[model samples]
Target chain A: MSDTFLPVVAGHAEDGRVAPPSTPRNVPYQNGAPNPSAEALRAQFADAVQRVDVVWGETTVFVDRARVLEIVRWLHDDPTQQYDYLSDVTAVEYRDLDRPIEVVWHLRSLPHRRFLRLKTLLPKGQPLAVPSVWDVYKGADWLERECYDMFGIRFEGHPDLRRLLMWEQYKEGYPLRKDFPLRGRFSRSEQLRQILAQNPEAKYSMEELTVLEAFDELSLEQRNRLRSGEKVGE
Target chain B: MATTTRTIEVELSTTGLDAQGRPQRVPLATDEAGNLVPMTPAPALEPELEGEHMLINIGPQHPATHGVLRLVLELDGETVVRCVPHIGYLHCGFEKIGEYRQYNQIIPWTDREDYLNSPGNNVAFALGAERLFGIEITERCTVLRVIAMELSRLISHCVWLGTFCIDIGAFTPFLWIFQQRERVYTMLESWIGARLTTTLTRVGGMGADIPDGWTEDLANFIRTFPAVLDECNTMLTKNAIWVGRTVGLGAMSADEAINYGLSGPMLRASGVAYDVRKDFPYLDYETYDFDVPVGQTGDVYDRFLVRMEEMRQSIRILDQALKRLPDGPVNVDDHRVILPPKSKATSDMESMIHHFKQVMEGPRPPIGEAYVAVESPKGEKGYYMVSDGTSKPVRWRIRPPSFVNLSAIPKMVEGHLLSDVIAINASIDIVMGEIDR
Candidate 1:
């Protein structure tokens, strides 16, 4: 596919007039030749892997959700293809597309000096999950958490799946999704200030404070009443 | 294993007796059936009394930390059993904001990531956008970018050396290095008009050309910097206190560093010699000649040594780039991509209209994805951009090097002394702006 992606360098389309590389997509402007290792990988994971595509010398291997763990584990364990470094884990949300989110994993085989991008597209919604590669690379611990924190995508076997950049109790929509607005959104500073002010020494443990922070502006009595289903709760 | 037996000086008359007038022997452990059970004998110093585990909080506000970095350290006595870092105090959600802004507008946002390496960040972002747009810049642009990047790396190392020395209780190196750092800012000021947050480069090319006689200032800086480093080495490096504190502290093996996704000096210190500039060349770095320094043992001292050597290499690259600097247009001449020059926009009709359109509606790149990486002073700082054939990008993702490098801190600091955490953290050279972003 990469070899055939010649992108018509200053060449003409079938319509007779010559076309420039800058006007269209995949126009082979600066020579994004196909990677040979991607072809070798396709042969290696013949059945498990669906397809391999190279763009601008980057190899992206498309696989099913169930095979992500197996594919990554084998990649790490294989003698020649030891992608031991899990560099970055991020998701791109496409609300209009069939698969709403693409959970992208960028892996590096440091000893071999190669890069592989593993992407799994999933249906968009809350409580989405994929297999965790934490066991394979320890660096994925926080990066996976950050992915979950931002996109609400769960890595199924992640040991401690907690929000990383955003506070756990700031319950709201995922910031990175297209559906979320860019401005005039929620900010946790006021609530954080009140919580900090009430507890001078921060006597509450992390777990306890997380639970308390859910009632943003409610008083202790009102929160108890709401929990107990008593009168005046509304 | 040989066991030492101590001859007790207890008098026979003082021996407690049971009903049969024999000495009563207390059992160390007992079985469920009331029968005495044998237990493993204790070693000379029975480390069994290691005491209860305690929690140690390092910072979110601690002065020793480089910035607003909080570490929740689970400790057993003075040793760190586990170190969990809590970041994001400086989170401005730069990626989310980038989605709303035009491609060129995001360069300033990238500056906030690794504030110490804004020029490098600008180049990395511009390179990514340029790839998506398929705009190959001039040779002059590439050379200028290389010079700015190397200068940024030098400044970053300067800040790292100063703070790291102060962190390890060496007071003088901090003062000496910042003097060099001040000169770096001044040199950059001559070219870009700002010191820290210059926002100096553009997508298709540089914002502008350097002022006259700027390279001479850079050449002067390069000439006299090594002697200062040598002076610093005299103060530390082999100094008894420096070696004792940093030699074996926070040591990690090569496999462990790779497994934790470590890069730059941290990875090189482990002897992998994996530098993105060499492994994956960008910005005509392949044309340059320099050797990557690798260290055998990944420790605080090795990281320091690797960084010092890297500074020297940066000087070498800078010298070469200055000598071979091309003469041509700095910004790409494509009006669709680049903002028109001020003189042309005011004087010519076509340039006036092109500048108006470009300023109002930003460049519309084709619907595609591009990821460009540069070997930043900290690590591989990459910009992953996904465009949707519009003025703004659909997704703007940053592979922040400092954040990734900071992830290896817990792995480096675990099982080490608490104070060694400071040494290990400094060795990583984390700027919280990058990590939190």
Candidate 2:
């Protein structure tokens, strides 16, 4: 509706043909040419950008967690850079527990035909939180939620940032975290017990139940339980 | 009030014929203008109910949902006021699982996520792994991968077409198109030895090459598949029911589609013409000639048209790939990644040592990360692998396209009728395995 998406990007030949993009042959593990947007990003947000690394011909710019949202907004809104597409929002937790957790955002500039990776590292001692880019790209909604669900990272300012891959009532630790065991924290029998103990009527969230306006008609005990900010139905 | 005698002459032809195939000539009442009088004075209209919105839940397990995707709809009468989609029904934690498995060992898991496009997933993962390992695949392997990708795309789009038809109440096309899907599966079965979960690629090469005369079978399929597609195209492309159900429904502008990270047919249908193959080429897809069909309105019908044309273009690519497929080794000559031949390993001690090391410890990529995306039938399916100089990756991430595309459903379905939600959901072509993964 805002008319920001251009009809065509680079790589088009003058004869109305798409320029042939060949597969990279014998690409090195590191030190490939970085995306030009990385230079522009560093120039635009000098203090926010911590470092840039070109690995496997992909450019990764590590930015300060506090300024990630502002940098992303600039990347999306800036006409010359125009990284309008948010490909993925995921986090990487190294096997070494002492290493900081890295949150990665893969952004594609269709107008400029460039791909840039933005990362923000959260140290172990501090709370793992990053600003949400939902305002810039609505597609980041579920990606950020899944990141929160999997890695227990708080996406500040994401509306309805509940657990995505895991249910709201799931009690086990983040499944993708380094400390989480391969065979889950709870034993199989405990997992089964938890499943059976779940209230069927609690399938709909409290926000969803408000649509029916059936709160008043509920049992007094159930109403009181819901009023106490508990999510249980019985 | 019509106490006076009044006869209406209803046009018999307009009323349609009876069971006997003749026009029924029932007595009719006419006003002074010779117009047909109302039957029973037009039954009084039902009183409008206001101030109450109903809630409807469609499956975590409904047939129309295609898979385990649940949607909670708040409806103001039959019109949907809001739609809240709940996924994760089939979340098996493939990414978490990928962290434990070796790079080559993770191929089978990729097949299970997007089960319909398993081969394409295999090719994408292998490409990512190869990039991380800094290994260059063979010329023959490159063309073979192109064939596999296009064939996989064909199968996926065929399944989409069949299921989409069934979703919109057309039964014949589903059966017809599924017959074609089975043919492709049969071909894949011969090539990979498994039909559904074909772990068809390794780090540097394919699982196997085409058996003798297999290219002829592919050629035959490419030759005859279009006729079947043409038949199906005639059946559904301009059908009055299809046009009525799909046109102008769940439309997204190009700007919104790109901002939402849509790709493949979903993005192209919005008229952006941004295809991963054309824009970011892999597997030498640039060498093959094909057209990326684009649509104007980005509606359900445009998605349908884009997929149909994409299948035809895949045929063209397949035809070109078949001709250009060179004669050489399928796997790279690198012993670190590819294992030695069994005969050579049995005879030569050095070959045996190479095989033993590769099998025992697995191929380890350098401490780095690579994100490789392929234009899967659903969209841009990407595999982002991060290695800490280990055979197993530090983090393995799947950028599932349907997950992002389906994220926009709440925006697309809010203002439409409840029935159109099914049409719109089918248009998104989501595989819950991929979305929930």
* Full-model lDDT for every candidate: 0.76, 0.85
**Which lDDT tens digits does candidate 1 get at residues A58-175?**
7777777887888888889987777887778888875365555888988877556677888887875545789999889888888887888787788989876766776534445577
lDDT of 1 at B262: 82
Clashing pairs in 2: B7-B29, B7-B30, B8-B29, B8-B30
Model 2 C-alpha lDDT per residue in residues B1-437, reported as the tens digit of each score: 00112111223223334474333334446668887543344555856776588899999879989899999999998899999888888999899999999999999999999999999999999999999998989999999999999999999998899999999999998898899899989999999899999999999999999899899999999999998888887777655557667877898998999888888888888877778898888988777777777777788988998898889889999999999989999999999899888999999999999988888888888899999999999999899999999899999999999999999999899789999999999999999999998
User: lDDT per residue, candidate 1, B312-410, as tens digits?
Assistant: 789989999999998989988788788776899889999999888888998898877777778999988878888778889988999888788887787
List ranges where model 2 is wrong by over 4 Å. A1-20, A214-234, B1-47
The candidate scoring highest on lDDT is 2
Provide the TM-score for each candidate, comma-separated.
0.82, 0.90
Error of 2 at A177 (Å): 0.2
Query: Given candidate 2, what's the lDDT at residue A29?
Result: 68
Error of 2 at B298 (Å): 0.8
Show model 1 residue runs off by greater than 4 Å.
A1-32, A95-99, A125-127, A187-234, B1-50, B346-349
Candidate 2: tens digits of C-alpha lDDT, residues A79-136 = 8888889999999999999999999999988767788999999999999999999999
